[model samples]
Target: MSDNTTHPERCRCCGTMAVHRRLLDQDPGYARRRSRIEEHAFRAMRGTIVQRPGCTRIPVVVHVVYNTDEQNISREQIDSQIEILNEDFRKANADISTVPAPFAPVAADARLLFALAASDPDGNPTDGITRTRTDVSGFVDDDKVKADASGGKDAWPADEYLNIWVCPLSGGLLGYAQFPGGPAATDGVVVTYTGFGNMGTARAPFDLGRTTTHEIGHWLNLFHIWGDDGTGCSGSDFVDDTPNQGGANLGKPTFPKVSCDNGPDGDMFMNYMDYVDDDTMVMFTEGQVARMQACLDGPRSAIGEMVSCTPLHPKALPKDTPKEFTKEPIKDPPKERPKDNPKEFVKEPVKESVKEGPKDLIKDGIKDGGKELPKDNPKDFGKDPGLEPGKWKPLDPPPKQIFEVPTKQLVEGPVGGKQAFENPLPGGWGNQPVQPMQPMQPAQPLQPFVLATGQAPSGASLKPPVADGGGEQDQSQALLGEYAQLLAQYAQLYQQGMLDQQGMLAWQQAWAAYVQLGGR
Candidate 1:
């Protein structure tokens, strides 16, 4: 029987139903509160991304993780995505076929560019993109499949590389994206194979190849043009310059749309993050460029830490030929062979070539498919930190097996989010008012629970298990997660048992404090 009480709350990194349910159960108002926090966060971050003519160029490492050879999309496809970013940010989209002749002149060109790296995050040499091959395919929206290293997803140094996971999007959606600064914010891109590029599996017009450009915009902190209201026009996207939009547009919109009486530019339908076919969506407003810049300059400034701060690369290496052969000892040297001529001595072949050179095969990033992916739905998680009685389980001793995590790709075709999830306008996440004063109490120094990296034991889900043979495994690492889960379950049971209101508040407070302390 399906466990309705525990709805697949596992971390995408590790398939354990061990994730904290607090985030899922969070009141929708939390989004509004989070947006409020984002406002101040963006205002504070804008200062960092502004690059004047001679400003430092941010160096970035791109890790291209593929499930297999066919899913191994090429280097050029990666390059194309970068090219689109440079163009979109600089407001130099190749063409505005949708723009009426009247407004083509004011198109803005925000300045940005992405390149194959000339240096590694550590001031070493590199070619910007690294490729990994994983046996896993059929990417799902679920994060568990993609996180390979940690019992959860192991990330490339989040502060340094721009990790892009390339795999077949199992679901038809162009992959989903995470905004900066959330717990999972450190995660990388998951572009769908066919949904990714304009030239390859990517289709045309809609495939003008802007899906990634749009998602990355989300990565860098830009919102859907209509402010992602998900519905309703009363909400405002918060940007002063953008005209109020009634909701999200799905199929190609004819010009002069009269919703919310927006007009002239109509719906700003050409904006990135809209549902129009790729080619139809064209520009990002100066405000959007500013917002994105603010993001790069702000909360995500770590992305710049490894960028072109240095200027050198080891482009070549020495050959392995030995320079000078060591001479034989006196006794061995006495029998010199006759040469064609003393002056024209013949050379002897040496059995060993002692040469020093840079290792060429050292990959710039983790190789995918090097490990088997934990099965899609790990059947049983042995000792779930959370979940209910007899539902989840945990891995007693963690296995050190390397894994294949889910990589994301673009959501191709006209976006049908309208059907699956409504994005009606003006009042979504973007429009939510900024309540900047939400108090962030100073972090209380509390004892931290030990976290062991483990996977789901088989039963219902497919989490990987660490093997310690038969001896009793040390489980101190289960830490805050199990406790947090237990606490939640206890509260649920207490609520159902007619616990007094004060008792419930105490339970809720204790739970809130645990999460506040980053429990699990």
Candidate 2:
């Protein structure tokens, strides 16, 4: 049987009947546990149990599941909700003045304050709002939305925190709550995102964040003021102060709304536990406060004990611990031998090899005043050629120009037989005055051919070739082909179980060769 209670448009909270159905269907022993809770509440109302000392601050975590942009409420909106909860729970709501005169004296401060947890369950600092993007448009009272697998976040430790889920609710449910003694995973309340916070996506009639206030009342073990019976006075909220009413009220009710033959005083329709618009609900009566206080002293005592400060991550290893290596060392060393015969290398004439040296290319490109990029065709600079030209949007106003200073600030020396720049520019670079243009140095002879990888030293540029008939395209294709062939050879060696450090070194050399051949 469907036990969900549907309310009119003004307020729709399916609290007691929904929870009763869920527990009965899911647990065999729910009835006995619920009866015990009722007995405890009854005793508290009759003054057998004392209210808790001072105010108990309950730490809260709000999970926001959004399908649209607006549903992801802002920080201010969350803060507003918390503010409203604090006001309503403590009986400090500004509208408490609107409560009927007869019911005003019995309105009690529940002495509860709600705070967003300062840290998450993992002990990391948090603002207490978790946002998740979901494809599900709305959630019924089925509780599927309480799981990460079901497009919502799993609740934090229910014993330590009040987990509130803010999302769009299906079946016109403004909100619902799991009364104490339910499964820990699904503990806490589900409030519609549109009715959650006063700001951002909050709709009319429900915009003041009273839905959370009303649902949280159930979480604290308070029953509906009108009782859950269908328009019958036999149903009781188990509180003496609240007048017997026919059923849940809608919109706003005038004073002296007599029901069930209660004449001089009428139904307390302004109570938070009743189904009314956000603006209509006003306060929780003293009898209701006693019932909720009994719950805190019984089922929910642990929530008051938890410290919401940031906790350290569970998997964080101690700094003093040493790491163990996973793989065994290679048995074979690299097979690439050092270049053969350094003495015989000087026998080759220097002039014949000058074009291969990178220094000459730089000198040739900059011999004129400054290099010019081809009219509108800026170099693609190692980017994918398959990129659609239509998608390339030019910068409206280009970034500020950076001055390229020549290599005069450097000292030249032979480093591992390759020309290396020495004495780099010092810090506080902008303080130094720009130097006059220096005369170009004579081109140096090339080093013995060895494949080089990685970037040129800072302040050096790879000069693109002068405009020739598709020479750059042909060179790029040839380099790419060679790179592919070298990769194929490496794969074959691996398959034959012949690949070792030597093969790895060969692959590195192939990459260097591609760079040298202007593959970019």
Candidate 3:
């Protein structure tokens, strides 16, 4: 305090002045915060992917809680933000007047869209907008907004709606978002108004308005365009076709400019997620969209659920107005899409019918022993029903969408690939090859059922059924005999008082008849 400016630095702990020691002795607040952030990241991976299909659209409520004057943004700007999201997620962000021809052809149209939610988490219709004034204003490290967990955003039925908080923070970091595991897992994305869009909250020129587009990209599980790898392209964001590049690009790159050893493609400097200055950014690739979708389907489905309301759509629903009436926008350089005549909000009601689903094997032919063996022929035991023995083994169905995402219903709601779960079987779901009953020889000679490595009593080799004899009745008789032994045991146990009493007498009579015909 003697002289603030020229005073030599000193360790607060011991007053030993040394430039290095003073710098090191500062509060250490930032480093501690970083450790906490990392620790929370570790907690996120223990999560689950969304597994159902055709879940309904999820609704979202944007609460713009502002304090400072700059944070004061208009609804139009917010609407533009939602529009950019729809185009980016849907992979339909076409309309290339903004991008150079060379890059236009390669632009990926993400398969997702956004809308002002039509209802609240309680299923009541809403304008999907809310405003609050908070002393909390300024830039933040994560997203520009969040559904506060404790009183801040209030505990939302997170699996049903996204709570976007537009507030200020003290960090210079761009924007940040949570990675799956869910709303409780991490705070929602946070962005600075100046960086939100070219339209709202931002100044012009710098506002070619893709900030929200970029931040929302992260919200959908996309990483930075440069892959955030210190090694760049070699580290990849795990996408299949995106060329790798070292670091992010700031102000736009002149055509044919090259950097990051990502030759040929040079740098994906134009990708929206890159750190490039506003006007320079142009597109998000299909590969990037897919990667994001994988996240949506896998660990982040809960967030995706915020898009749906019930067993149906989780969040962003489609326009009720016919496709022809809606405005088709993309993440084009700002002002490309007409923000003037915004489409009227359409609250499309979702319809679901639990039509008769296929009956499961367990519900049908299965018996006390799982399922009646096709006719105890020696050859039937453990053999694929005519399936090429080598070609078919147990396999999962191909992955499918957790939500019944109708590709054709692209007009209905947000079509995030993240919301899609791959059907886990080959040839997709319903095409599951029927698993024919295994061929186990007649009872007493075989083990009940077998595991992948389980063996049966020797002579596991089947004695094929005689072409003319040992009729179906004989086979049924043999199986019935086995059932009789089980029934007798049940009765004997009851007689010895080991079984529950009320039904004991009926069980005994059933056992007597069951054993009459060649009971084991």
Clashes of each: 71, 1, 80
lDDT of 2 at 331: 27
Q: TM-score winner among the candidates?
A: 2
For residues 68-121, write the lDDT of model 1, one tens digit per residue.
666566777767777776666555565544565544554445455555567664
Candidate 2 structure quality by residue, lDDT tens digits, 357-392? 668768777764254555334556545554754344
Backbone clash tally (model 2): 1
Candidate 2 yields a Cα-based lDDT of: 0.66
TM-score-superior candidate, 2 or 3: 2
lDDT of each: 0.46, 0.66, 0.45
Q: Global CA lDDT of candidate 1, please?
A: 0.46
- What is the C-alpha RMSD, rounded to one decimal, of candidate 2? 36.3
- The deviation in Å at residue 31 for candidate 1 is 7.6
Worst 10 residues of 1 by lDDT: 447-456
User: Which portions of model 2 miss their true places by more than 4 Å?
Assistant: 1-8, 305-520
Task: Provide TM-scores for the models.
Answer: 0.49, 0.57, 0.46
Candidate 1 positional error at 395, Å? 72
